[model samples]
Target: MTYTRSEFPDTFLFGLSASDPGDEALTEGFDSFRFPVHWQQVLPRGRGEPDSGGLDHYKHLIDTVLRRGLRPCAILDSSTLPDAIADLGGWRNRDSANWFAHFAETVIEHIGDRLFSAGPAARSWTVGKSDHLGTDLRAHARSLHHHLLATGHAIRAMRSYGMTNLGVEFQLDEPEANTALHAYFHGEYTKDYLAKFSPNLPKNWQRDFDSIDEPIDWCALNYAHFKDLDGSLPWSSLHREDTGETPLYVVADLGSVENTENLLGDIRSDLAQGAPIKGLFAQAQEGECLGLLQTALSGGKQPAPWVAPTKALHGHWNMVADVGGTNTRLGVVTNGHLDELHKFPTGSLEDFQAALRRVRDAVGTDPQAVVAAGAGPLRDGVIQLTNASLTLSRDTLASSTGAQRTFVINDFTAAAWSVADIKAKDVAVLQGSGSPPPGTRLVVGPGTGLGVGALLYSEGHYHTVSGEGGHMGLSPRHRDEVDVFDAARRIAPECFFADSLAIEAEMFLSGTGLPILYQAVCMAGGQSDTPTLSAKDILQAAQSGADEFAVKTARMFTEHLGAITGDLAVALIPVGGVFLLGGVADKNRWLFGQEFLDAFNAGGRFDDIRGGLNLYVSEMDEFGIVGANNFCKNALAR
Candidate 1:
């Protein structure tokens, strides 16, 4: 059967390796091109400043690819080290890693935005033919080890420059011959290098390797020749599954028309047998081979860019739910206005599906779309509540509510989305002057658990990014705080999940954390006979000034909250505003006074930036619901 490109998955990328940008016809039928950028050519000396002429040449080539509506995959050639660096022992030179990292950073800063994918260097650095290095096994091992190290450094540098979609290239050989060699190669690149050759590796090399987290996002396999198809296909599939790396298969060295057809046939057979191939590429060094591969790939079209799925609301009747740890708030949006709001204890329901069913019954109308924000980590369209024994999923929400589409987002993400609709009356300002400018906004609060999310504005639309900022390690500032923190570490060891005496922000900032903080305060004051008080009791006592321990606990909690919020604000630079939400903040607005403001604006060098930030305590109890409604409207409009 003659196979067509239509048979492959829509997201599967098909492209070729090209050096000449002037040859526009070379990329006519391809969606991507693998452009090899030689380090020796760009940096010549492999140190100091990069050559402007060489940099512009590659930049122009990348620009041409983008101009022609094709994605460019750049591969930095590590094999061709600059003459100066090679003289100093090339990859074997320990300092060469830093030089390569610098080069990677420079290249990424210049053209990272335009490229679809990038690699620190060609894959041959790790798995190339080892015969060229002679009989010195230690030298050969060190060279290979340093290459991997340099690649790791380069990957980190590229990521720092905001380059995502990074990858690595590997050459695939015969299955039997590859199995053992590939294992050794993979082990060295991953976590097992030090175990195998600790003596040969550089001092403290394990620490450096440990710092790298799953360096590459994808792997490009160079498929040249495989005699045993049955043996090779399964091995390749197993390798991809084991490494958890997306595989992009490239048929290397296309010679004749017959050879190209045979390779294509092999690819078709692999696809038919369920090979996990995410992309396909053809390597044609010569003009004739390029023409042959192009003709063979005729009728193939570039896949459209992937966009997150959203359901358009047919009318104004949309359902929104804020699934908090203690209570669940459900509301209906009519013509962009929220109405028919209902509240119920979250613990009373079995799961989110039952809650959705109750809302549907109360409203007597099926929602066009449903957006449920939960207080937990969202994974695979589901959330397992951190404080409550409840689970929510998009499928369950859709089935129960009879909505065309459903969204499961973090509770803080919902709060961040609400920032666009916040009014002057609903906000109580604590810092800065007038209204905040249009940029990034941060919404963080302490409730059952500390929630953190950011709203980023780009292309005239707001995008929400959620994070587990509450788990960040908290440090004491003064002597009193240090004493309380140390006491808490001894009294409540369960709250410290990390190293000894390491207290997480949520361990003292959330509603659940308040009771622990109060107990710690009593212990620090050498009063161990005090009764264990609930978070509510402590808050009431503190508000009435009846208990000094409770007041101290409240004060410590707000101070830590300010410090953590300030740290996050500095890191995120939420220029729009820093919003404080959740029940604890709403109920205890008086606690967030001068001390909280002082703590927030306490950055040593960044004091001016922190002081200039607009801080607001959101009094709106339906902030999450309103945010959900806004999110639903925006999604539907999109």
Candidate 2:
């Protein structure tokens, strides 16, 4: 059973499993080990005095490990449930999450320095089918929900507590299954089944139960021998079943020297098959476990920091996409920068799947991760495009594009990404004289629809506030605008609803609103000869000075946009500046002429505020795509 630093492959690992509370498992044999601290054992009384005996036990264990130049991998919580908290409805009660977070922080405050990564709760606690009776499914599901929330809170606390090296644990209940139903506990089948099983919890809570699918750090796989009388299945039957391919994985815990060698052999087979085996870990009471993985660690090579948990499976390449009403743009990114760009009409394809394939084909590259921004509302990782037939789902898109992970964000949010570090020359000055100030910035664009978002700089990072600001009520400028608003409401009542005597702005300032405004203007002027035209036609006719109705329509759209811009400036104050995007703003620079500026600057009592605000029209052809790429980079880096 004696192994050395020269016998095993380079990408192997050794670790111990702290099954009990004592330091007996802390002996020298592994590079790392998972030590579980019972909640009640440490606190004894939930929130009372610290158990001195308990504290001394863990301190001695960690100090001994550190003295031996070993890494003590602490597991904050495993199967241990404190009796005090359990009496108070442990995990089921909403307050239990906070209590658990407090415990995690306390541990980090004490022995965090000697640890390889922050101690997070075990995988068995957050995911897996309940071992309790089926009738208690509701409580069990609720417990999972609270544990996930607490996990997120603990991860954030760990980052804030200066624990950069972190790992999240996940393992298939039974790795060998023909379908995803039994293969992975984290799947739609399991989620929907659980939802049906527990209808008592809030619908929204059940719906978003799986939102935390992947962790922010590395994913640790805890595997043990599945055969023999002590284990569940017989070894002959287990080996007969295909466990499928695990391209990139981290082997965390194994018991015996035989199991360690077998798992290492499996990793070696994966490597031979041209599949990546990221790393491995061996766990045992003896030093032989570490000796077995010593050769693997002695190679002095380490896994890349970019490697992520389950979803962000690969660290080599990523993709960024902007799915808008009219166009679908894509690009390949490397090291947080755009490497290639491709574009296609949004409606030219049936759905996001075909569109992604087309873009990938044109670019001639396969990305492991994709960050797509679309113009629609996103729920449960799916987006229903506001103006197109495409429905982009994060899971579906990932499956279609051969990406291990995918993220879908609002299209406006993506466009706002470009505003973070925009140069002066890229924008045409629409109003004001100086550069943007030092506060938040706003990006409002009108195309198929009005897109609105704001950017704020905080904690040395740019945070985007994406919302439906475009649908807010509109305020008319003059008596003529009153008649115009009435006419607009008469034409398209859906766009103009008087809530407390305030009308919606999107129906008057967007591309779809332009045609409606043209019809309204014709009616106001009593010109029956004016023909119905599209927003684009109206703009062309107005620019040619051929149709008076068209001219009026263009004027109305421009002025309304300017008015909304002014209102947004006062509302969000975007001291950084207001960025104008979309085809409408980029195409009609003339429409935003003196009259539009007049309407924008005419803030009445707040005219000084408008006068001090900088206004610029964005001319970036790939603003959203660039933003998407930047967003993926920032997300991965974080």
Candidate 3:
């Protein structure tokens, strides 16, 4: 079931839970019913309800989601509906079909208007019976079929009503029907229930149902079986056993991480009976769930041509570094771009040694003609490491000659190669909506460490610019920010940039900048003892306008970012505009849009310079990998 990442689609579902509670606070009741449900817990009663401008909420939510290049799929929950009191088990007063039809209309009226939408359907949700209804196979079966047929009909009806783009999906959705042996032993039902049901199922089920492993589209009955044991046990105990086995220890309630190993164990029985099942809804883990999800979702996204990519001319480089926290691999491209080839680990000297050894072991040559002294810093994070702690290779050298090929170089310089290359891969983020003549581009990365660089776009190609832009002066935008910067300066006054001889610019933009900012805000707000907040905490405080320091920090961070972007804009005249790179650019996009944009466009009379200063929030996570590859491809060829 485990396949390489290469096997998966470029865009696959990476949904994060966002379930919120609705009428009656029925989260516990739904679980009590012994069915899987989406308990999307969100602050301030999740998005879009009737009072929440129902239809408008749906449109805005979906549109905003797709705008980020992520497809949206709604996981409908019983909690979403207005609270109503009804008897347990099929208790909606009106028929279940009528209830769902109403729900479908609310969804389609807004979301279905979009041609690119795939589904607004419920995910892994049951169609019948509350916990008090008890266990009834016939009822479960009848309710499931009824919901599917009704939902399908409702969708067709919606289409008939001119909402042709509406989509409806059904899941088998039964957790009580795991192993026959469990039903026989600990199931709430007596032996008569199984004895009657088994005989009703095809006569061949008992002998071969357990072994059937063919891919079956059981949309009529999306099975959630997660255990595989050939023994008798109570349904409750069996259910616990099935959920307990996991690759990683998980704390789940009703709808939580479990197995998909034997998810559809009994679906074969129904398939053999000529049942028309269409898809599955298993919570995959390890390799099992991945296959089920991929296989079932092979249909892919619809309404093509969603994005447009411009032409990019690649180039080569002399060096590269793997600035990753783990699986670090750096390389020097003596004859090409750093990405196309591998750079030995030179973020640290020991890394340098190991990288050298890897090459020596592979090529069997310790040549000594060119020694350009390649020594990486003996440090990591803010914690300094001795040379002994670093990985060393025998023949790793930045120079062709080994003797003098070991000297200190900026890790940011190595990091810049990839950053600049990423700017080349997708320049639109910086280039803006309409095409601009290729111009110089700026790349700023704020991750575990802050990395900033600029790349020249000339003659339709990118030329990497090497400079310590991040190490420049810490230009505080607000008085509070200035105070915070001064406070941090007190802690490490000697931490100014060296050789680069730049003033500390990271007081508000780097990883080191965050803690300093967070502390200052908390202390100023008189919440200094607020549990030693993280940078994220400070930003959260600002969102609520809780602390002046936090608001100040957020403003300062954005404003400084704007100043940097503006400075780089002037330096490169990046006719192509400016690009905010690294993890920070992507995660804090809202921040960039508000503060950065406000500041970037504040260059006095030169504000017009920002007219085409294409600002973009990159969605590509593999920019480094692909950028490096692109760099390698272009450089090696050159």
In model 1, which runs have C-alpha deviations exceeding 4 angstroms?
1-316, 347-352, 361-365
Q: Considering every candidate listed, which one attains the maximal TM-score?
A: 2
TM-score of each: 0.50, 0.54, 0.39
lDDT of 1 at 204: 68
409 Cα displacement, candidate 3 (Å): 7.7
Over 1-638, each residue of candidate 1 has an lDDT whose tens digit, in order, gives 34457767777777877666576444576777777887877888888788998899998887677776677888877666777887787767777777887788777766666778888543423222222555555555566656656776677667644467887665555222233234323443434544554577566655555323335677666555533333223435555544444555564656555555666676667666666567666663556656665664575665763221222112326789998877888887877888789888888345556777887766654676899988888898889988788888888787797675789888888888988766767788888745555878898888777888898878667887888888888877777777788888986776676665668888888888888888888988999786888888999999899999999988888788998899999998987889999888888888899999999999999999999899998877688898888888888775
Best by lDDT: 1
Which sequence of candidate numbers ranks them by TM-score, best first?
A: 2, 1, 3
Which regions in candidate 2 have their CA more than 4 angstroms from the true location? 1-238, 241-315, 347-350, 357-368, 379-381, 402-405, 433-438, 498-503
Per-residue lDDT for 163 in model 1? 65
lDDT of each: 0.72, 0.64, 0.42
Deviating ranges (above 4 Å) for candidate 3? 1-327, 330-395, 398-431, 434-437, 458-461, 479-482, 495-503, 524-531, 540-548, 622-638
| CA shift of 45, model 1, Å | 59
